[model samples]
Target chain A: MSVTILYKEQPPFPVMATPDGDDLWLTLDDLRSATGWEIRPEGVCREGQCVPIPEGREREFVRESPPRFNLAALARWLEQPVLHDDVHGVWFFGEAARVRRETLRSLQAPDFRLPDLEGRMHSLANYRGKKIFLVSWASW
Target chain B: MWQGLYDELKDRSFVVLAVALDSGGVASAGQWILAAKPTYPCLIDERHVVAELYSMVNVPSAVWIDEAGRIVRPTEVAGASDAFRTQMDRKTKQVSAEGIADRQRTRTAYLNALRDWTAKGAESPFAVSRDEVRRRSSGPSDEHVFAAAHFRLGEYLYTQGHREAALPYFSEARRLHPASWSYRRQTWELEEPGKAGGPDFWSAVDALGDRSYYPPVTL
Candidate 1:
């Protein structure tokens, strides 16, 4: 299953678990909430996890469920922190869970396949028949 | 030691594949592996797929897979050698944290024993036989399974902008699986009445305000 975390004034952070695997889509709000400083392709920090928000095309959509208080206006009233991405018109809130629990070494590992920096798809099945030692670390 | 040991045994029908769980993606993990420059195959699991598959609760936990693709050993913290233990002991005392010595001592012994098994395979005295491994790896109970489902549902709802709706599911998950840090921490992360990064100031010690929800984490 997938989940999305959205902010009042920004886009949403979409975490989807597809049949093939899981994919993460960050809305402008997601980018802002994750990192105090927002710029597409720049780093956003949420709960100590830093995520890279790449620059992309922007789109406008209406909210199906508008609160009695305009979330965007309320966000301003509450003085909630807002960060902006360079390429997108959307704003971001910097208070979302940037890292999922499944990413931790303590959690059960899910099977997945995704392209590498070289654009090659890699999966756990590729390393079957050998002893595997998986270590997780990041630059930031 | 992992590299040295793996190299020594690779020719003997033993292969070591290092999987990196770095979410920063392959380039980040790749740099570290290259710096180490070990001979073994280093792989990356950017999202921690192996961790979830093995129910790994901590780093350095390892599973021994036999030739038949069965896990000869479930996830357990593999200790380093005796020499490494001595170095760790020295470091622990230097840091001087309370209980550090004891924790280090236990960790050292665990690692040393694990290395012994890694070298000896099933021949090592510490090596558990196939039957024992199977017996130890019985799946989580029906309660845990249901709790995991509820916890996932709660997380999903919380992500869907339904914080209020998510509360009951989180509560139910806590009721079903008290020992699971995932359920407890995820709920606790939300229940705190502040922004995401704000501290969890509520000292409710027992996440289940009602004692009937489940047992305490300490229990």
Candidate 2:
């Protein structure tokens, strides 16, 4: 059956889930949607980094009415920490440790592709090799 | 003075890329951009990617990257100049006297330090060692990382027109990173803008004690 999964990174929604004994499992798709990471052959991947998922995670979390998932396990697979509210069916994923470590070592600004007006695109790479004063301000 | 500084530094191979993190995209920052008529390449960050990636706690926060693409300075409060305090004072008519003073002190210090670093480059006293940069911008503690993710999620939801649903994530982000004014002010302005004018920046400061609003600048 389906159940509500409240993600710290997403609005609460009911997705395909299964009650596997006492632990609740979410569908593979739901897991990907709740977090921005994607399920790929190389494991779970975010924009610039990928970490390997344990063997059988793709098959393991797939099954049932929709399908259940161990979000905590997925968090571990991504080298992140997670908290679940069993009653409300919420999950919170902390940062990925491996990715954080890599970013720390590189000290290179995180790369992102954003669009400017006229729908044209811009990325930090465009200004690479130049001193950049990346300032952030909001109208508010 | 950003454009002025950019003009002077352009020949020196420096550029000031100012990004507006307004959720409303161009619409939000249009007036200021038009008024200033900046010559540099001004960009818009509707999704706040720079803030999330660079740990931008407040507006005018800046990261300085060297020619080699290494961050010479991590994200820190950067005013265009000391005159920023005068503009801020006029803008924030409601901030307590003490808060205003604190803002002036930090603003002048940050501006002078930026000038020193710009003039002296690596030789400047304000330019930190690589190790110190790592220490200042390290993992930033686990809570902050999660807070940033949640903040991004909230920004996405707000952008998607899910203001009501986006609130919890914003609240969580503020709770996790209490010192982050960008997250707090954005959400607060949406929820309850002050009756007189503007977001409740002062009330938020009051809630966190008078002097606790801004973190100490690394000068």
Candidate 3:
């Protein structure tokens, strides 16, 4: 199946998956494309961290017969929030709770980059060494 | 209003980064930004990323950041006064003398506090300690986290021309996180032009009872 993956604030990307009930099973390549993770001999590994699949729980996250990885199960294990729009075939993933809590404790302003009316990108990081009154509004 | 403040404080190394949380993107928020003729960096957030990142629930919410990118003040209602709701006629949009006066007073106080912070930096009485800022900041709960994902999915579907298909996800997001006026209002406005402040809004505000619509800014 072809499904869309919406991650963080980036644009959604399409990937191939085999969704069973609520669990979205993707091939190792598709898993790496949708989420920046790959299942290694050690465990599911990303750039900075490696989360080892629990002992005897490998069946829940992997299937050797078809060679598929369960993204929903991995998200659950990592405490990353997931939402599925079955009708549209889209899976949305949110930041892990640990990351948000770390930001909260550090009291650092959460940084973001967004485009202006003319399509010029501005970053919160660019405003360092200045006092920022970051205000959000809406037309409606 | 933000432009005026920005003009006053720009020479002091202060910037007012006004963000528009409109899913309609430039089409909806463009005219307002143009009308302001702002010189500051005015950005449009189609995904409501800033709101989700800062745990902000409503429009006109703000967070103050200092020179080192530390959050001096956490997200809170920026400068709106409740007199608009309490003193104005629902249909006529007429406000009483008291309402105008109260609105002006509250906005002035908020602007003054902002000015003090801009002038004095971390030494300002308005600048809170690191612990206090952390205390005021809220990390999203499991429900809120899921609500954000659902809301983003709804936004994607809506943009992909599946308007009817998008409604259920939007409704689910509202149900999961009722405190987020941004989610509710964004969906309502995208559905219809002026529906955000209509009967549904009044009914919700009335239900608040003694609870405040805008969180009181403790300066």
Candidate 4:
């Protein structure tokens, strides 16, 4: 069997899939390309951050059939809200925007690491004591 | 826009940092920064993380942080000073067939509010409470989350030199978030042919009709 994966922005792409005990398994490469995430030994990683996949859950996610990951299990590990249309073989993995919105109520800015044009790393933590007038503009 | 504000407020323990969300390429953005010769830090957000972090749907959005690092104002269409509006009016006049009367008025009112906030600080009526900020910006929904994901993917693919592969994702993102001019503007400018120097692009017939993209501020 095969499954067609549909993400929010990109066109739908299909990958070969096979039925497991009760879940469907997709190849590691397909998952990585579709989601921009890789299931490393450290669990799932993008950019530099890695979320360590817990011990027993590793077995639950990985299947020997073409060496793939279970779609449901991957979404659970990432703690992302997911919606799937089984008949259509489509899946949408969303970000933590809801959590982000809630956190905004606390007025505490979310922290992330970014590089300045000079190639120096600057984290929001560095600006902890200083006020930031974060102006978002475009050259266009 | 920030130069005078930054210079004047610098002695008052205030600082202005501009985050340029120029995804297609950095050269033009860099050039603009050089011409301005700002003392404040101007950072580039190739992936537009800062926009996503603040749920900003358009360029020129700003978030005001208090001395304690708390958000005094959530992301809003923020450039109130005359300098900024004059610059905007000049550019919009050149490109847009219609006069930018509405946008000019909006910017004038916004600058007034900004002055009040700067003067009064915590006591200012313009400074929103934490709850009010969140409520007004409106908590993100599934569409917002999905749009953000698509935007990131599109930006990544485009920067990777996979322009063909990136187009569909950009289309989908624009479809999902019609109000988000930042998504469309960045992509559209990349598609722009010839004419490549210093702030020429503005609302075109194709860019969601020839109107001021900036939504009116409540303040």
For residues A1-140, write the lDDT of model 4, one tens digit per residue: 66655443344567777644445577788877766668777777866878777787678777675588776676656655555445434455555665667767778876756655665667666766655677877777
Off by over 4 Å in 3: A40-42, A64-67
Which is superior by DockQ, 1 or 2? 2
Alpha-carbon RMSD, each predicted model? 15.5, 5.7, 1.7, 7.5
B10-69: candidate 1 lDDT, tens digit per residue? 765566655554433555556776678877656565434454445443344466664445
Quick one: ranking by lDDT, best first?
Answer: 3, 4, 2, 1
Question: Candidate 3, overall lDDT?
Answer: 0.88
User: Any runs in candidate 2 off by more than 4 Å, and if so which?
Assistant: A1-52, A55-73, A79-98, B80-120, B193-199, B207-212
lDDT of 3 by residue, B141-180 (tens): 8888888887888899999999998888888889999999
Of 3 and 4, which scores higher on lDDT? 3
lDDT of each: 0.44, 0.66, 0.88, 0.67
Question: What residue pairs are clashing in model 4?
Answer: none
Predicted model with the maximum TM-score: 3
Location of the lowest summed lDDT over 10 successive residues in candidate 3 chain B: B186-195
What digit string (tens of lDDT, one per residue) describes model 2 on residues B1-219? 378677767766677888887666777677778778888777887656577667777877888887777887888767533322233564645555665676667666776776677677888878788888887785445777777666665665566566876778778888998877777776666555542135355455445643533355657
TM-score of model 4 (CA atoms): 0.69
lDDT tens digits by residue: candidate 4, B23-96: 74457577788788888777777767777667888778988877777888888888532223334345344523
| 2 or 4, greater by lDDT | 4
lDDT of 2 by residue, A1-140 (tens): 55555443245566766655435566677777765556667866766778676666565533455545566566655556454434443344555645665686578777767665545777788888677777776678
In candidate 2 chain B, where is summed lDDT lowest over 10 consecutive residues?
B79-88
DockQ score for model 3 = 0.81
